[model samples]
Each structure stands twice: as C-alpha cells, then as structure tokens.
Target: MARLFTGVVIYSFFVFLIMTPLKAKPSDKSKTKQNKYGIALIIGNKNYKDGVPPVDYAHNDAAAFKRYVIDILKFRERNIIYLRDATKANLDSALGTHNNVEGEVQSFVREGKSDVIIYYSGHGVPGVKSKRGLLLPTDATSNNAELVGYPIDQLYKNLSKIGAKSVTVFLEACFSGGSEGGMLIKNASPVFTRIEAPKSNLGITILSATSKAQLASWDNNAKHGMFTNYLLQGLYGAADQGEEGNKDGKVSLLEIKEWLNEEMTYNVKRQHKRRQIATVIGEENLILASVSPGRQFKPIQAFEKKKTVARAQRGAYQTPTISPSARASLNIHESYKSYGILPIKLKGKRCVPCENILIASLEGLPDAKILRGANARKADVVVSSFLSRLNVTQEANDAYASAKVMSGMFGAVLGKNIVDHIDRSTPPSFNIFDVELMLTAKDKNLGVSETARGIYFDRKDARQPKQSNTVKGINSVFRQAAERLAVRLMGGTPPPIKSAAQIRKQWEDKDQNAQNGNWSEDNND
Candidate 1:
C-alpha cells in the first residue's frame, strides 16, 4: 500500500505541472479590467508662413490622424483630442482645460483613473535651442514659432502631474530624435523620464518618425506618414505576427517595433519610395496581449514539425542528379548550406490598395500637398519601385482597371482608412531572398534587406546607387536571382508589362490617397 501511494503521488505531481500551464497562473491574468482605457492625442499641422516650408502636405494629416485614432484605431472618441488646424486658440483649447487637447486629457485620466496615453502623427521643426524639437501649430509664427509649437517635454510634465502610469508617443515628422532615449530637463538638469513612470511609477514609450538628422515624409498617400500608419497596423495585429506567447491578446512595446519595422515598411514601400524609421524608447508592462495563444501556438512546431516535411520536399527538387562530373564541378548551395529562399505569397490586396487609392485622393484637395524636399526621394523611389514588382499582368488590365474604377467611385464617400481588412497572409509568391538580391542590383534599389526589415532599402541609400552596395549580403543565390529579375524588369522584356510606367504611377497615386483618407470602402453600394 505504501509503494502504491508513492507512485500515485508522483503521477499527480506531473498532472499538476501540466495543468498549471493550461490554467491561468497568477501572472497570466490582467490586474484590472475596469481600469483599462487609452488616451490618444493626434496632431497634424500643415499651415505655415515663410520660406519653403517642407510641410505643405501635413495640413490634413492631423485631421486624418484624428479619425485614425478615434474611428479606425478604435480609441474612445471622447478620450481622444485631435487637432488639424493648430491655431493658437485651437492649440490652447486642445491642450487646455474645457477643451479637447491637454485639458480633456487631464479630465480623462482623472475620471477613469486609467493610465496609457498615446500621442502620434505630427511635424517637428528646428527650434531655437539648436537641437530643440518643436511640434508645429496652425497659427505658428516663424519669429516666436517655437512658442506655438507643442513641446514634448511639456507633455511629459503634464502627464506626470496627472498621475498616469505609462505614455507611448508616436510622432511622424522630421526631427523626432529629441523625444526619446534622452535626458528630460527638469527646470534645467537632465534626467531620465521614461525609465520611471512619472506618477505612481508609470512607464512611458516614445516612437519617433525618424532620427534627428533625418526627415519624415508626408502626403496624400494612404500610407499616411510612414511611421504612424505602420504603428497603427502594429497595434491591430502585426506585432502579434508569429507571436506565440500573447497572454492577454496584447503585444509588448518591443514586439511592436520588431514587427512594425518589417511589416509596415513593406506595406509603405508598396506605395512610397521612402522608408521611415520608428525609434522606440522606455518600457511598459502591457502593450499588446494575445487573444488566442493555444490556437496560434507554433513556436517549436514551426521548426521541428516543418523541417522534416521541408527536407522531404527538397529531395524532389534536388538538382536532377546531375552527371557525376557536374556534381563534382561546382555548386553554390553546398557553400551556403544555411542560405535558401524564403518562399512567400504576398497576399491581402483586395482592400489594401483600395484604401491606399482613396487616401492619395485627399491630396487633390486644395489643402493637401506632399512634403517638399523633406525625404521625398525615399517615398518616391522605393515605393514606386516595389509597385513595379506586382504581377498584375497586362491580361489583368481589366481587373486592375475595374479595381481602380471601384476605388474612385467609393472613395468619393468613405475616404481612406486603416480598418481591419483581411487576415494577414504570406508575402508574394516570389522568394524574398531572391528579391533582395535583385533590389541590390538596381542602382536605385533600397538596399539589401537586413532581416527583411525596412522599406526594401535603407533610407539613406534610396535613389542613390552607392548606397545599394551597402546592403548586407546574406543569401547569395537568391540575391543573384533577384538581380537577374531586376535586370529583366528594367530591360522591359518581361511579361505583365502592360506599361510598367503606369504601374509605378498607380502606386505613387495610391499612396497619396491612403494618407489623405480617400481610399474606397464600398463598390457602388
């Protein structure tokens, strides 16, 4: 009886360990559900008085951003403060009490007592402090302009006083360098602000559009200021891609940067030529949570389970048992054993392009204009280049034309948006490893894809051949194939060449609609 009891006890212990994983542990469950709330302040300033402002297209950015946060992003409208025309009165009203901007922010935090404020989408201009960053306002003046622009430090200070726990800011503009990973001035001394939650130990995260020395692009493109649109998509589901441990249906701040940097850049390049970098700072407890961990669990399974089948399939594709002499001669595969093509089928086009077209249409309005001399090369060249890659054959001209017609008809009403369209799918059927190589060959290529991230090329190398060589060499054969493909493309001997120029034109045009909120949602419905 004693021996039997011992065995039973051991079995029970194993069961308990297994059950613990299936059951929600203490750390698994969220602390509070009622306290859950998010606050967003989206600002876009386009009006300016003076010489060659590089921000003409930003006029409607703020307004478009407001809708994204409230309607598309699903932030509670009441909790959001959107400012399009940043006149002094509007700025003060939006930021002050009894108004939608800062004042309302205070009220929301005070009332719901929840933490997490998101500020995204805006332009930053050079300030008097030499390195000081300024968020431009509608009625801003060049002389005392720095005074009118929204100061990021003030935002941190104000939110601190409100006792908020965490703040994540996403700014899509030039000169976003000063906002994160730097010392925040308190009266004068520099101090770390994000590392510590301003009030009640709250954490903060700031993601800027580009580095201090770099510039961000703005226009009517549905891409909607590279950084912000990608940030938005990351929040929805992109961050969670390939994620297996999403306990609360959420993604962490880190995960978001990883996924957005790759996914969004790819999406943006399909329209704009430029690639924007999103810099993240600080930390947070919960950024994104998983909705279905078990259903999507595939960590070890992806490799262990798939490898065997993959190898078996490889046997069939093995070089046709070439002659013994040929086998002994030379081969690229043996030297680069780990290197291979990552076969992907770039899907999800139905609503995506439609949305982009509508957004680009917004620029057609008198208020809209693309950012001038402010990283235009990045958007124009890289984005246009990718669009030329689409397999939209001349035979599909009717399909492409039909899609455009549908976009124009619906765009007149629905406007461009980033609403959830479809389940994410594989990338285009082309082997990405090969695509990277071909891109590298083009004197105007974005650059070699480093881990398939960024806008198909490095922003600095964009439109410049010297920069293309900077692309890191990873998969040699794939790269060579892609280079060959690029040569074929530029040579204009490939199929699906209905007017390669037209394809590029459409892509550029679509980007304009996406940022401007002119993408269509319905087809004559």
Candidate 2:
C-alpha cells in the first residue's frame, strides 16, 4: 500500500463525539460506554530546583494541550487530566505516585476503558543507561545524580492491564547527555512505539519531539517547545487540510511525520532561526483517532488488504492468490480489489510492484509478516562482486541524481516525470546509486521516463552469493519510499487536470515568453 505520512486527528481530541447516550437514561451498554473513555495527559515541567529552567515546559504545554483537547477537540473536562508540580496528593489523584505512576496509568485506563494518549514535556535524561525510553513527569527530581523519571516499561504494563487497545505517547525533551550520568535511554529525542493493547486489536503509538542527539527548542514567539508548537500545528487541521488520507478523519503515523517535517522546518526556522529534528517510531498502519466533526467510517480494509497482498507478492516474486477458504477464514472478500501494488512482471517473474517504493520500505520495516521470496535465493556474496559486474557506466544520469537515496527510490517508482527538471548528466562521486533520465520534447508529453541504473547487485563472481541480497535490500528501500510518496499524493482522489491541448497551450505560452524574454525580472528597479 502507499505509505501514509499524515495523522487523522488532533492529538488534543482523540475521539469524535457521536451518538452520546441519554444523560439520565441508563442501559447495560451505557456501563461499557462509560468505561470506554478517552483520556489525554499533558504536562509541562518548566520549573526545576537545580536543573535548567528552559529544559522544562510542563506547565505551559500541558495547559495548551488540555485546552485543545477540551475546547477544540470537544472532550469533557472530566475525561482529561492535566498536571504540573502539584503535591503528592494531587499527583496521585491526577496520575499516580512517585513509585507507582504505572499503577495509576493502568487503573485510569481500566476504569476509563478506552484509548489514552500521554504527552510529556520536560527535561529527559538517560534512565540508568540501559532502558529504552523514559518519560519524566512534572514531579521528577534528580537530587542524587541518579536519573529518576517514569519508567516506560511500567507505562506499557499499565496500559496493557487497563484493556485499552490504543495509546499514543508524545515525548518532548532532551535525552542525550544528562548532568548526571546514568542509564542511556532512547526517549531523549522523538520516538514512537506501538505495543499490543489488552482485550482488543488496539495498539500504542509513540512520537518523540526530537532525535536522541538533538535538542527540543523553545520558541520565544510561541512561548512553547518548538517541537510541541509545530506538533500542535500539524495536528488541529493544518496537516489534515493538506493531506489525502485525512478524508477518513483519522491521520496515520506516516502522514503526521511528513506534516511535521514540512511544518517544523519552516516554522522553527522563522521562529527560532534553527532547524530541529523529530523522530517518529511505531506501526506504519497505526490509525490516529479521527478529527472529522461527525462519525464517519472510512474503512481501510480494502486499501490495506491490497497493499498487504502486493507486499507479500512483491517479496515472493509470485502472483498472490488467496483460496476461498482462507479468505473466508480471514473474513475478507475472495475477490478483493486494491488500488496499490499493481501486478507487474519483472525479469519474467510475476510479482506485485508498488506504485511507490519509499512507502513500501517504510511499511516493510515495521511489518515482519512480509517475507522474502525464492527469486533472491541465489547470488554472489562478495562486497564488490555483483557491483563490479553490473553496467553502471553512466554517472548520476537520471531525475533521481540529486534526491536522497530514499527519495530517489520514490522517483524510480513514480516513473521519473515528477522530477525531470533535475539534471545529473555528470557527477564527481555518486555516494549512492542514482538513475539519470533524458527526455525528448516529444517524450515530455508522456511525463518523466523513470529508470534505475547502478550496480546494486551481481552474482557473476563466484566469491559473493549475497549479491542478490544487496540488490534486494536496495530495491526494498526504493520500493518502500515509493509507497510513501504514493500515499501522500493519492491519499484522496486527485483533482481533474487539463487535457493535452491545454497542456500544449500552456507550454507554448511559456515557450513564447521565454523566447521573447517577457518574464518579470527579480530586481524591480
């Protein structure tokens, strides 16, 4: 399937109000509904005893996210929790205690009985040097140099106990070098992880505000964490407005990343005159809650099934065929139709090919179910064996010459016309394999002719049988990136475009203007 890069809803509002039960009336289902509550926990710890004040913003960020959740997202006040550096009693009532935040989280989840999202903004230090990631709540203190924060494991365990299916966590803090050395943790930067939810098909998604080595900046203009500011912007409609799959009201994790990249890059530059990096980790297909005003179900089954089949077939190098019994068992239509992973023949081998490769790669990394096939069973293994034999005589000769390796992969799958303007006929050193495309005036009408040229793999030499593996790895990356591009561009049906005649007229006008030097000059004077 096309890799999605947009989330579906505003983080402040995780649930859409639909069919609320009567206030006084009571029914058996009402009990279940009461338990099915959605909760958002936002904390900004801006004050610290000995630590840096700028390192924490737990109060401001939490307040903003709370307002968004309630006012904008329409969540009830009782359903959400906001915490600052409150007393132990208030902390216990709101979240949990110093030693048992996990228990509180679990109990809240179980009692609430629904999806929960936790947002933490504060100073994050490596937890004892061995843990994956940790979230420091507002009450965190580091008196003895040993880092103390809410252990992520306990949070996961509590979420599991509560029978919640989906939980999203956002961490905006620095984790690289703490004043006091301790366990190295992964949560210092932006990170996302999806874990199995209890009693349901729900999952957890984690979004970190920065990379492990990068710092989450403060915005004097926004008076909020740079990452959080851009994040909120990405949420609450800016991203959804520009995204394709947002039609369903839910934004996928991939869409969120793309929107964040675009928004943060510009917003941060203008706001702080610097660039910040955020990392998104988790299930690619994980659905963020809907932001649409009404209850609208945009079932992804049709789209998901098609991409799954395509990915499976692409890996196996064979046509995907589902038996009637298996389809029935899986509760899927026997004759399923998908708009992704169109069937194609490569090297006389029947296989499914994604419309985009980068998306395929991103999706493939998370899904262990997709397996490699027999077509790549044999190849040379030497590091330079297969590469030395392939015909890579041309240097950066295609539209992808300037693109990042991942982007180049997308260009390859999109048939190249999307980026034909990039000319890479010559290059000094091609750090990564790139394809160059040359277009004729007549061919320009057909769009870009996408091609891949490079010695990605070779088995001609007896020493290296892993040649096929190298090629497969590279192709896999390309395929995944391509899928991401497709998801971004085709999330929704595209607008209609002009006919060839219109295109010719437009082209002719531009050509005539160019010949006469009729375009406006940069210097107005």
Candidate 3:
C-alpha cells in the first residue's frame, strides 16, 4: 500500500511539471521597448527614363534616412518599407489595399496605436487640371504626369483612412524644379502653385523642401538633398531648443520647423545664391522622436576648439604692433576697446529695417563694449554701416532682356518649338544686395572696413513686399556678418567657415568609411 501511494505521488508531480509553462528570457531585440508603435515608408525615385533630370543622390539620401530612423529613432526595421527608384506600379501596389502598406498599417493600428511616416525624395510636378500636387515616379514623365504621377492628396487621404495616431509626410521634391543653383526643367513657365494639404481630421503634418515656385536644392558636397540633410540634423538633436535645466530627450515639431527655416534659408542663400524657405504645416508640439542616449548633441569640435582658443588668446590682452607709418595715419597707440554704434546708413530706398537690424546685431556682441548715446570722442572706435537695396546687376539685366526679345521674336517668326529652346539657353537675371561696415578711430583718421554681399536669383514670378519673416531673415544675415567683423576687430581669429560642399564631402566620406568598418558608429550615434 505504501509503494503504490509513492508511485501515485511521483506520477502526479511529473504531470504537474509537464503542464506548467516557464517564462522566457528577453533577448537584446526584445529589450528595446518601443514607446510608440511607428511605421515608415521611404521612397527615393532617382532614375527617370523621360526628359526629367534624375536626382543624383536620391537613393543615397533614402538609405541614410532609413539608417537614421532605425538606429537613432529606435524604429523596428521590419516596420519600415524602403523603395529606391520605385516605379508607378510599385508605388500603386505598395500603397493600395491588396495586402499592401495600407492594409499592413491598418492592421498594425488596429492591434495597437501607431504613427505613420511617409517620406519621398524625387521629382514633383504641378497638376494641370485640379492643381493637385503630384509626386513623379521613375516611370513618370512631364507629359504623362496626370497618369503616372502619384497624387499627394490621394496619398494623404489613404494614410488618413488607416486610423493611425498621426501621419507625417516629408516631400523633398520641388514642383517648379527650379533650384537656387539653376533651373531643372527647361522652358517651363515659372508659375508658382502652392501645395495645399488635404482636409483630414487625423493629425497630419507635411514638411516640404521649398515653397510652390522654388526648386528643391541638391548639395553635391553632402551627397544628399539640402533639405534632407538639415532634416537629418534636426532628427539627430540639432533641433533641441529646450533649456538646459529642463532638457527633455525629445525633439518637438516646432523646434524642427524653426531649425529648418533658419538653417535651410541660410544654407541656400550662402551656397546656392538663392532663397529657399521650408514649409511646415502641423501641430507645433508634436514630439517626433526621443533623442537616443548615444546620439546626444555635441558641439562641432573644430568650431568649438577654435572659438575657445581665440577667446583665451584675446583674454591675454596682447597688443598688435603697428608700423610707424600706419600709426602716424591712425593716431592710435593702443587697440580700441570701447566702441560706439552709430545708426546704420541706408543707401537704398527699402533698407530702413536693415539699419535697425545692424545696430541690434552690433550691440549683441560679447567682447565689445557698446557705448549707447555717448559722444564719439568718449569711445575708442565708431562703427558705421551702409545697407543697399537688392538690385539686378547690369550684365544680368542685359542678358535677360536680350533673351526675352529673341525668344519672343523667334516664337512669332519661326515656331513655338524654337522659342522654348532659345528661352532655356538664356540664364535668368541675378539679384544682389550689398552691405558694408566701416570701423573708424574716434579721430576719424584711421579706419578698417568689412563687407557682406549676397547675390540671389529670384525665382518668384513677382516680388512680394518684405514680410516679418523676410525681415527676420535679413536681420540674421546682418547679425552673422556683424559678429564676424567684431571678432576680427578684437584681435581674435573668427572661426573658419566651411563651405557646404566641403562639409558634405566630409560627412559622406565618414559615413562611407563607417559602413566598411573603418570607423565606429559611436562618433555620430
């Protein structure tokens, strides 16, 4: 009886053990918890069979963006669908409901809430009939835009139907195909048509590279589109605008927009000699992504180190030796320390606001002591500024006028076909703005001068009156120029300015080497 009872107890224990489940240990992939479920569709259509010029670095831009979203944003790789040189059919199938992105995203949303991000880097054509924005695929052509082009409004509507928590669209393509560098499309009318967002209750944000009439610029140095590069920079935490004490790890939509507006405008003006304003429409406080711990913002070592060394050297107060002849003309033995800023002189009709900006900028310098409303004799140096109106150079105006006459005559005498060819061959007029800063000794004998001039080709059909944003942009330019001049006057070397191309080249080479394991991701990530 005892042996039988022991056998029954052992049998019962074995059954219990067999029926029980054990908890599985989480792996590295599982350990990475996602705070918000997100899905991304990235498309870069570079190869175009038609007359449309191919976007040289579209594919590279897409790949880099993919790496950014996955590595830095902590997005699951499986949730991302990447397409390069995609055709119309591929886009249609992917976006359609037949076991495609729409269905997948919808299913994901139904299971759990998710955010959708749609990014496109390609050519965009303005719709003729409905004035809808159209994204050109690899198989699309200027003539067949209506048929092959992906309607941007349709895309918004489709994504909105998925019931995702939010939808963000990034269009790096330009409808005008006109860049600050030059025109991409030959002989196309420079009519600016705005891209309006579709009416949707779902939170939808659209960030466009340029306004309706502007060209989306490509930076050969960075090997990415200019807008996309800045976008990536923002994603990497360059957009963080929070105070140090209250530093949150997330980048807000407002921060990104502000960063893009300032950086893009500055870069386009500097590199392309054109004006490009990034457009953003959405809720400002939307959190795009939390900054990764490994990718926290770090100041550029080259710039920061140079500034530090300059400041230290300036603090030492070493006097610069002047030649006897120079001293005789200058009537100064020691360096000028305190400076007084005079109201900037306006040389042109439309530069009153520029004067105010220049004065404000001069006062903002750190090392300089600005003596306000003080007599010139009380200060060591007096700073004067002259701002000129934007003007078309004589050479540019002549060329444009000649082209217009020739094209008009050719269209009337020969044929409409010949007119387009002639018009395309003629370059547009260039607009230039000149700003000069003169620093003189209190005695008015010795002086040093600096100038900042900007040349741009206006792509807008008609110039609009200066708005607040325009005024602010102009102020920023003057401020930067003033800051550099102040540094020079104080016996300190201004930080070296890297060209957009040089910086982009370095970034591209670094990314390339990293892929080959010659560099570590720790540097950037």
Candidate 4:
C-alpha cells in the first residue's frame, strides 16, 4: 500500500481521504452557507525560461492546495482560479485588466463580499531597486524585476481593491534564495527585506514561508515544500485546538500558526541544521476552515503503524514497573553507580543562566552521585541536556512596552483607553524554551537509554516593574525543570507538562499586569 502511493500520488490520496464525506451523516452545510462565496487563486510556477532555476514541486503543491480548499473548506470549484507554470502575460491576463478573468473575480467578490485566498509557489526575488519583494512568473527575469516581477505590494493592493470581506495570502517562495534543496538562484544576497502589507479594513492576513533572509526548504520525502505540507495538515484538521473546549472541527488562523511554528522549527533544525522562522501577520482568530465532526487527516499513519509493530517486537526488553523495595533488591542503584553530566548544548541566546541552574540542581540531588572531569567518563552512565529558545526578539519586547505606555496615556486623555483595552485581550510575546535531557550507559553493554522533554515559559519578564531579578526568575524555572527530569530518570512519575494554553495564560496574566502598571516583585518560582 505504501509503495502504491508515493510522492505526488500519496498526497492525492491524502486529499481524497480528507475530502470524502462520511456516509449517513449531514454535511457541514449550515457552516458552509455562511461562507458560500469564498474564492481562491492558486498559482504554481515550475518551468522558468530564464536562467532562474525551476521549483520541483510547485505544480504538485498547487494541485494539492486546490483540492484542499475545494474539498475541505467547501469553496466552490467554479470560483477557484488555478494556474500552472504561469507566464508573465498569463498572470497579467488573470490578475490585471488584460482579460475577463480579473473582471469576473472582482465582480464576484464585490457582489457577494466573498472571502478570498491567494497562494503562490515559485521563485521569489528581492527587488534590487525598489527594495520590495517580487514573485516571479515562469517567463520573468531576475535582473528586470520592475518590468517582469509581480510586486508583493501590488498584489496586496489588487486583492484589497477586490473588496473582499477577508483576504488571506500564502507565499511559498523565499525572497532570499538559500534553500538546502539546491533551488536557489546564483549570487543571491543573504540580506532579507520584509514584504509590507497595506493598512486597510479588508482584514488581510499573510503567511510567508520564511523570513526575508532565510531559505524556504523543500522536503523530498514528502515531495512538497516544507511550509505548504504542514499548512495542508493544519487546514485538514490537525491544528484544531478545540477553541471552545470541544473539537467541533473548527480551525483558526492562530491554531494553524502554532502548529506550523512547532513543526517547522523542529524539522528545519533536524534537516538543515539552520533556522527557518515562518512569519504570520494578521488577525489570529480569523477562521481559515472547518472540518466535519470526527473527520481528521493523518498523513503518516503507515509509518507510525510500522514503528508500533517494531516496538511490540521488543516487548521482552521493555522496562518494568517496580516498587521501591523491588528496585533495591535487584541492585538497580548499583547498576548506575556514577553518572556524568556533559556540558549542555545551547541553541539560542541568553541560555547560559538556565544551563548553570540545571547543572547545580543535578549536583545538589542527594545520592545522585554525579561526577566531573576524567572520573566522569569512566562512570556507569552519562547524561546530556539540550536547551532551545524560540520567538524571543527585541522587537517583540519593544512592541510590548510601547503598547503598554500608549494605552495608559490614551486612557488618561480619552476617559477610556482603547489601546489598553485591546492590549488586555491580545496575546503577549512570551519567550518559549524547549528543554530535553537524555541518559545513556557509558559502556553500551547495559543497553540503557532514558529521555525526558518539556517546554517552559518565561513570563515574569513581562510583568516585572524594574526587571532587576529576571535572571533569578529564569534560574528558578530551570531548577524546577531539572528536578522533574531527575525524577523521571529515577523511574518516578511527575505531573504532566503544561499545555500550550496554560503557558499562554501565564503570559496573558503578566500582560494584564503590565498594561495596568500594577507590577509586583513576586517571582514565578
């Protein structure tokens, strides 16, 4: 079955499974009625005539996307305008006034106030003269962007002119061509300039594959662009976070962004050994799509089933649940007499303090028998730790602080603070850390390996008045993480790790305090 569906064929099967309606069940007709006039434009340019290299999977990506928006999102097939290997003239006829297609799209949008989605997968070049982002057509040349390239700003303006109730844009191409899949142009600069959106009431949202300076990756195994593959998964219901406490099959833009961030960060790190930060700019709560009840997409079920079978075959060596007395009688403690702690590998900035705290906590554990230097290498077991921080930026911190101040001043002048009111409801840019610890036997004769993983949030920095004890607060959090990891290694069950919502709530509380100027010296230890 796996061999029968590989590459593009497998993705088609996935789309079919997701689109097929269940038997004897009512369709989501009621919900579809509200968005009956939704429209989409999907363009995939793979065959470039100029010196620019061709994208291997752009056409296939466009095909899969068309199926998803039509089958899962319930968009009318007649309303979707799809183009493959689009040339400059073809794009002008479709998007501009050269042909009847553009006029038809505008009329439909204006008459019905439709929801609009525009997706492009191809080579993207940064404007050398205009300093804007450009999406290239199949016949476009890189040197003459002004004449041939489709300016992103123009794209936004054109979509806004359609007067749709909401517009969503997905650009699966990167401005800076540094992809690992050998899909970049020759002599492209590493500097990235962000594509700007128009400030309008059209409720526009944009999801870019990567930042200006980063490379958008291609996943050969999945035979799709890394960003688009995960995005389809989210739209197919893998990102449904049950916003109303029940998985009623609705997926919001916010949930999709979360899933993309988590999956892309891990995948890019493993595959490219570099970072690819996806950018999401828009109203987060906007509804992208919804699925029928009990309908979900699982792309890698066959691989997962194979893994389960392999694990079942190793049942004889599986770890057993033993009481304290039984563990002592079996001399389990003697088996792991001396444990060595390696110098932790840090993946992000400002993580030295957390590393120190973890080392200290492990050393302080009574009867843990941790060793250092030469003696540590001859120990029975060795432990190593990895720490990664995501979404930590100076821009985010500046925006948070500026919003708080502006909200307070506006409230004093207008008798009601509009900025403050909005800030109270908006989510804060909390710094998230992914922490993992692994233990392995030094001799390899013992065949022992144990692992623990968790995510931690640093929220105290946002709510504190003076930010004097920020390092102390972070250290405290690290200590708690270390203790939990130790307990798990010692065969004890700690409480479950906090969910994404719970971590978000911690930042939300701090944001409220910062907005109210009611900061306390309390630590989140």
* Best of the candidates, lDDT: 4
- Model 2 per-residue lDDT at 129: 45
Put down candidate 1 lDDT per residue, 348-433, tens digits, no spaces: 33333222222232222223222223343433122221221322111111122323333354444434431011101111111111
Ranking of all candidate structures by their lDDT, best first: 4, 3, 2, 1
The regions of model 3 sitting more than 4 angstroms off are 1-32, 97-112, 177-188, 241-246, 294-525
Error of 3 at 233 (Å): 0.6
lDDT of 3 by residue, 1-525 (tens): 443344334333433443469687775441235534778888877768756677876765665566566656666655777677788887886676323445444555643377778889888877666677778888876567767788777777777777777788888888764433344444566545577766757568989898867888877667678889888878777787433112466778888888888887789889879888888888888877666554632222212112121110122212333345444542322433556666544343445454444443343232234554546446656665543343332224223454465445444764565556445433463223222233332434355433333222222111223343344445645555554554444334454444335544675576455334343443221
**Which of the two candidates, 2 or 4, achieves a greater lDDT against the reference?**
4
**Model 1 score (lDDT):** 0.40
Superposition error at 383 for model 3 (Å): 68
Best model per TM-score: 4
How many backbone overlaps does candidate 4 show? Answer: 0
Please give each candidate's TM-score.
0.40, 0.41, 0.48, 0.49
lDDT of 2 by residue, 59-177 (tens): 45655566455433454455566555533344345455445545444565644346677887776654444534455544455542234555455555555445665677787765653
**Model 4 over residues 266-359: C-alpha lDDT tens digits?**
6977887878778888887777787655444433211211111100011122233435743343233344345666554444454555544444
Cα shift from native, residue 210, model 3 (Å): 1.2
